[model samples]
Target: MDPLTIGILGFCALFVLLFIRMPVGTSMMLVGAVGIYMIRPQASLPVLAGEIFGEASNYSLTILPLFILMGNLAGVSGMSRDLYNAAHSWFGHLKGGLASATIVGCAGFSSLSGSSLAAALTMGRVSLPEMQRFGYDNGLATGAIAAGGTLGILIPPSAGFVVYAILTEESIGRLFMAGVVPGVLLTALFITAIWLIVRRKPEKAPQSVTAEPVSKRMASLGRAFWIIGIIVLTIGGIYTGVFSAVEAAGVGAFLALIVTVIRGAASWENIRDVSLQTLKSTGTVFLILFGAFVFKTFVGFTGIPFRLTGWVEAQGFGPTAVVITILVAYIVLGTFLEGFAILVLTVPLVQPILQSLGVDLVWFGVLIVIVLEMALISPPVGINVFVVKGIADNVPLNTIFRGIWPFWFAMLLAAVLILVFPQIALLLPNTMFG
Candidate 1:
């Protein structure tokens, strides 16, 4: 069979494996190995083993475990609760204020945790019950948490970004830097959407707050300064070249551990728990990454990505149109696939097409992340939505979906903004790395 035909069959087989409930990493690795053996029988096994080992052992990949450890440590330390309380004190008095605070709190927690499920589950446990007690709409309450949780991937220290960086050979630090402004912009857009919704139908969000003393509010903010300090030390250190991305992860993890211990949050038992959780999450990511490496290598050997890119370039679509098409494809796949699955499956195919079109890879990276963020909150398999639903069992799944619409719209707005003004994504990386 022609390499193109073999490539198509291999991908089809991978999808079939995915449909049969095979683990994504295993499915990809299996298909990739078979495809490689088919294409070059003599060298396939050794090549696959070497690629897997090389990809798995990269120093840059070490950041994944450390950042995840930092997030787990922060969770155990009860920092998210303090941050949520601080957000509520400031915004809880406004119409739809509790929901607004939930979104804000999620963004703050995303900055710390860098994992959508962690952000959603953590904040849902902390905020949902309070919103329920205040008579907030179930949809709004759940939606805010679900949607806001997606910021975990777009903000710095993002595991998804790390994976993307590793897959594309982009600078992890530059990609992390690229995310900051876009992340803040998306968060602001979500907040604005909530404000607009409440403004339009004030009855939807009835506010009931016993105002805290100003002193108490000040104290709440004071206690949350650790989040600010961690962000500055970790991200600021990266941008300033004080540490490489992996070292920044270590710095953040160490700082988070120190703060958690100082606050009496991280006992030996808690440390044990954090270590186990980090190991599980990190292992999962690395396994998937290794599979992706094998699959991408197969695709490269098959010449599929090159042929596809050349074909697309020949079709003469405008760069903007082609970019939109890729994003639309993500939305469709996102309905069923997890964000990481989509990233691993499509990035190799998409990156070459993007580069051939003369689009900036870093800008495209940020844009792809925004689309993946939407997928995280999308229905059915929207992981973050289910996470919030699991936390607030009484809240219907449909209600959670309903609540995420405004935030979804906000994400769309943010995507358009980035699409139109690539500078939002590019400025930070260029300014720092140039």
Candidate 2:
């Protein structure tokens, strides 16, 4: 078969396997290996042959496990609970205050953990019961957690950004820096969404009587200072060129460990649990990466990316139109695929087109992650929704799905902001890198 035909067929088969519930990593690897053997066996086998071990031993990839460990350590040590308690003290007086506080907590935790599901699950445990106690509607309560959880991938130290950088050969530091402003902006947007919901339906989110004394509030805030300082030490170091991404991961993990120990939350069992969880999370991510690398190379050999880029350019749709189309497709695709899976599968086809248009890869990356953020809360295959449902099982699946729509729209608005002001995603990266 012709290379184009092989690429088309292979792509379709990969999707079919995914629909049939094949692990995305396994499906991609299978299709890639099969495509290569059928197309031209000689050149591509070496790439697939070493993908498993090569990515495993990759030095730069060390940042992933280190960052995951930091998050897991912080989680096991109750740092996440402290952060939520702090947000609650300050925001618990407003209608929907607890839900808003949950969003704030998720954002802060995202800074530390950089995993959306972790942020959601941790905050859900900490905040959900509190919100329920305050008579907050289940939909509003769960929506905030599910939506806030998406912040994990847009914030610095994001595993999604790490994967994008590795795939696009973009600088990880620049990508991390690019995420800072957008992450905060989206968090603010989520808070606004909660406020709007409660403002319109006052009974849905009752005001918490948590009007704690100023001194008490200040003390609570003080407890959160070290967490802020940790962000500065890790993400801030990357922004100022004081540390490489991998080094920043190390510094963050080490500091997280210290904080856990200092808080007297340390235990041999906690350490063991953190280590074991980190190992599991890191292994899942690495396997997908291995398979993605294999699939990307297979597609590259077929010349599909170049041909697709050439055809799009030849169509006179212009760069903006092409970009808008891709974004829309991603928004739709997210409903069916996990965020990371959509990313790995589509970038092979889309990155070349964006590059050909002279679009900045770093900015495009931020936009992609933002869209993926929406994907996490999207209907049908929204993984974070399912994650939160598992935690808040009393909430109906459709209700959980319904709850995310407002935040999903907020994320969509954030994407538009990034589009209109590309600087939202690029300013830090440019100021730092330039």
Candidate 3:
């Protein structure tokens, strides 16, 4: 069989294995190994060994574990609770204010954590009960937290973008810079959607402000300084070239640990729990990354990605049309796959096609993240929704799904903005990295 045909078969087989409930990492590694063996029997074993070793030893990949540790530390440090309190005190007086505060709090936590599940689960636990106590509609309360959690990925230090940068050989710093504008824009759009929904149906978000003195509000805000300091130091340092991506991650993790320890949040028990959770999360990410590395090698050996790009280019489609098709494919696949898996599986193949079409990689990266953001809140297997559901068990699943509709629309709008004005995504990266 031709290399292209072999590649196609391998791709299909990988997905089939995934559909059968096989582990994603194992499935990809299995397909990739077999494909490589078929393509070049003499070199397959040695190449597979080298690929595994190289992928495992990569220094850039160490950033993943550090970032995960930072997030886990922040979660255990009780930072989310302070952030939620600060947001609630400022916004809780208005209709749907608690929901708005939830979104804002999630965004803040995302800046420190850089994991959607962490942000969603942490914020949901901290804010859901408060929103419920205030008589906020269950749908709005749960849905806002779930949808807002996606900011964790779109914001900087994003694990998804880190993986993409490593796979594509793009500048991680540039990719991180590219996310800032779009992240803030999406956050604003989500807040707007909540405001509009509440305005149209005030009954859905009845407000109940506690009679707290201004002194109490100021005190609550004081507790959030650690979160603010960590974000500013991490993001600001990276953008200014004062720190490399890995250095920033390490610094952030250290600061988080110190703050947790100083505040008495990181006891022996808390440290044990955080360490174990971080290890589990880090291991899962690295395993999948190794699988993707092997799969990409197989695809390259088969020459499938090149042929597919050629075939698509020969179809007489314009650049816009081709880009549209790729985005649509991501949306469909996203319904069933996790965001990281989808990114790993498709980016190696899609990126060359995009480069050939004169598209900007940084801009495209931001756009792809927006699409992945949608997947985070979509039904069936949306991880964010599941996180929220797990935290707020009494709220029916359907209500959470129903509440996410407006945010979904808002996300679509954000995607369109990135598409129509690529500058929105590219400006910061270009200005900073040029």
Candidate 4:
């Protein structure tokens, strides 16, 4: 009958719903509604309606659709292929070069598409066959693509960061800026992991018979210049304070449309397809956010976050110990939960605890995104691995899972470095926003 008891039962019921294959957003909404009604009968329906209107009318969330549109347009314009080709021209001759190139290409595409599934699906389609043609082992090839795709949520324009910012009421621009260094650091670590993999098992990735000529490589880079320019124009504009994150999203989407047209890739069918896909993705995100807000409100009413924070204090856990404990829980949850689900489900409970500990939120955002990145490749429900498996249908699930280990470890290293040196996540945001 107590609020905390109601909250506990609600969570158990919510997980049972999830186990029965209910949609996350709907499940959250249902549990939250029932919990609210149980706690206060008259408040439940009005609160649900109010939260829906609040999330729907939020002006800051305008960035979501624009960014999603930009990514969809970029995908339709063949930018992912161009990025992969340019990376291949530069790195494809080295041991494990194609796999390395795949990581680089994923990083590049991540700048364009902020969704991990989009990055994984797009790059997996573009890079997998090329690696196969070159006789790269299926595990190494698919693993690189799967792991690399996780970069999409850590790089600028990241939907993960956007959701985090929205949930925490932090500055989205600052979060975007904060993600930059850590994203590049993770990319480099992924490439290094590939190098180590091939060093130990050279036969996994065959050396190219001959490297491409400098002129050809330069030409390939040229083909990718438009995408590079769009990235600079949007992300660079934000860094220099010339454009807000929302404005950058608009301009980026517009430019992507222009480039799509110029490349003669814009047909009625392509336009229709991209538009519909964007709508579907955007709708899904909004639904999740709506559920998250209602669930957050219910949790707030229960006062669980405050109690948890108090419990931590009573335990005399230092800030470092508290953070480690939270992250370890995240790692365990990441194995079974989708990244966004992990985020929306936990952040309402966790944010106050971190804030009470005087943790820098922007730095914590970067760290959280990295863990979410790790989730994308974790196991069982590692969605990025599934995305890769969808593309490389013949590659065994275990092989792809095996391949992602090194990159997953690389992600773990990135998290550790960011944890040790918060500057790795904070420098850009501070330099730009302060």
Candidate 5:
């Protein structure tokens, strides 16, 4: 068979392996190794060894563990509750206000953590019971937390953006700045989705206790200062060039450490748990990253990216059609593959097409992250839904899936808006850095 045929079959086989409960990193690496051996057995062993050790030592990746440490450390600290309470104080009286507060809390926590799974797990634990106590509809209640967790990837300090930056060779700071505006827009869109649902269904989101006195509200706001301060300093420092993404990660981790200690969660056991969790999460990411590099190397040898792009260009599709087709493919893939895997597998094929079309790589990166955000909430493989399910076990899996529908479509609308007005994803990066 020709190289492209082998590559195609290898791709399908990787998915099959994954479906049979294989680890993503192992699956990708196995297929890549076997494929490379088929083509060049003499070179395969050295290449695989180089990818494993070389990827571990890659300097660009130093930021990953630092960021993960900050998130895991901050997650254990009491900010999730503080953030939720702060948002609850301000918006709790509005229709769907508690649910809205949950989104706000998720957004704030995501900035601190840079992780969707951590955000979903933390916020689900913090907010679900409160929403349930408020007599909110189960679908609306679980759905809001599930959907809100998606922000973890779209907000600044996002691991997804960091990985994308590494893959695309873009400036991590600019990619991060690019995420800010769209992150805000999507947060608004999600809140709006909650509003429409409440407005139409009426009983889905009953009025919250918006009647708190000003003093009580101020107290709640005061409680969230740690979240606000960490976000502004790290993200703001990145925009102004006071810190590179790596530096920001280090500083964020240090500050989070200080806060954890100051809050007296500094017990050795707590620190150990946080550190262990950080190590595990970091290991998973890097393992997958290693596999991606090896697999991408193998794929590169196949010339599939070039052939695929050539064939698509030959068909003479309009720029808009090509873009739409790529996005539609992401949506479909989102239902089955995890977002990072989808990104790793497709970027090699898609990047050249995008570069050829004269698309802005930074803007496209932001768009990709946004779609991945939707993927986290998309049914079936909606990873965030599973995260929430692990915490809110009494809620049926289907109900959580049903609840996320509005937020999923809202994310789609947000993606459309960004495409129509590229500046939504570009404005901050362009103005702040360029």
Candidate 6:
């Protein structure tokens, strides 16, 4: 069979495996290995060994564990609750204020934790019951938390950007810098969506009967200063050229550990649990990354990226149209596939096309992360939705999905703005890196 035909069949087989409930990493690794052996039996084993070793020994990947540990440690230090309380103190008086507070809390936590699931889980645990007590609609409450959690991957220290950077051979720092403006923009859009929702239907999120006292609000903000300080020191250090991305991760993790200990929150049990969670998260990410590298190798052997790039050039589609097409494909695939899985599966094929179009990858990285945020709330396989549901089990799955739509559309709008004005993604990166 022609290499393109082989590539197509390999992708088909991959989907079948995924449909059968195979783990994404294992499925990709299996399909990639089998395809490589089919095409070049003599090289398959060697390729597999080399890929595994390369991934294992990769210095760049050390940042993953450090960042993951930093997040887990911060969670154990009561920072998530402090963040929520601080936001609620400031915004809880407005219509849909609790929901807005949830978004703010999520954004703050996202700056600490780069994993969307962590943000959703941590903020959902802290904010949902309070919103429920205030007579907030289940959909609005859950939706805000889920949507807010998506910011975890768009803000600095984002695992999504780290994975994208590794896959595309782009600079992780540049991708991170690229994400800052878009991340803040999305957070604002999500809060605006909440306001619009509550304005049209005030009953969805009833106003707080009494505003927080100024003294109490200031106290809440003071309590959150540790997390805010850590975020500034690390992310700010990166922008100021004081630390590489990896150095930032190490510093953040170490500082988080120290704070936990000083706060008397780092009991032996807490320490052990944090360590274990970090290990589990790191292992899962590394497994998927290893599979991604192998799968990319297989795709390279098939020459699909080149052929696809040629075909797109032949068709003469404008760059904007090509980008829109890719975004649409990502949204559709995101409904069925986990965001990282989509990243790993498609970047190999799409990278060449985008590069050929002279598309700035730093910009594309932010754009793709935004779509992935949408996917986290997209129904059927909305992982963040599921994470929220796990915590708020009384809310029906459909209601959680319903709540996410406003925020999802908010995300869609963010993506559109970024597309129309690439500078939204490029400004910080260029200014800082140049």
Evaluate all candidate structures by whole-model CA lDDT and list the values in order. Answer: 0.88, 0.90, 0.87, 0.91, 0.87, 0.91
Please give the lDDT score for candidate 2: 0.90
User: Which residue ranges in model 3 land beyond 4 Å of their true spot?
Assistant: 210-216
lDDT of residue 326 for candidate 3: 89
**Every model's TM-score:** 0.97, 0.98, 0.97, 0.99, 0.97, 0.98
Off by over 4 Å in 5: none
lDDT of candidate 3 over 282-364, digit per residue (tens): 88877787788889989888876788789878987778888888898998988888788789899879987988888888888
Which regions in candidate 4 have their CA more than 4 angstroms from the true location? none
Deviation from native of the Cα of residue 267 in model 1, angstroms: 2.5
Per-residue lDDT tens digits for candidate 6, residues 193-221, read: 99899989989987764887899999998
What residue pairs are clashing in model 1? none
Error of 3 at 20 (Å): 1.8
Candidate 1: tens digits of C-alpha lDDT, residues 1-434: 88889999998999899988898998988999999999999768987798788977788888888888888888888888888999999889888889888888988888777898888888888998998898887888888888888999999889889999989999989999999999989988988988898888877788769677899889989988897678788889888889998898898899999999899977889989999999999888888988998899889988988988889978988899999999999988988988999999999998898888888888998988998999998877888888887898887788789888898889988999999999999998899999
Evaluated at residue 428, the lDDT of candidate 1 is 89
lDDT ranking, best first: 6, 4, 2, 1, 5, 3
Number of backbone collisions per candidate: 0, 0, 0, 0, 1, 0
157-191 per-residue lDDT for model 5 (tens digits)? 88998888877888888988999999899899999
Superposed by TM-score, candidate 3 places the C-alpha of residue 41 at a distance from the truth, in angstroms, of 1.4
TM-score for candidate 2, please give it: 0.98
| Candidate 3 vs candidate 4, TM-score winner | 4
Q: What stretches of model 1 exceed 4 Å from their correct place?
A: 210-214
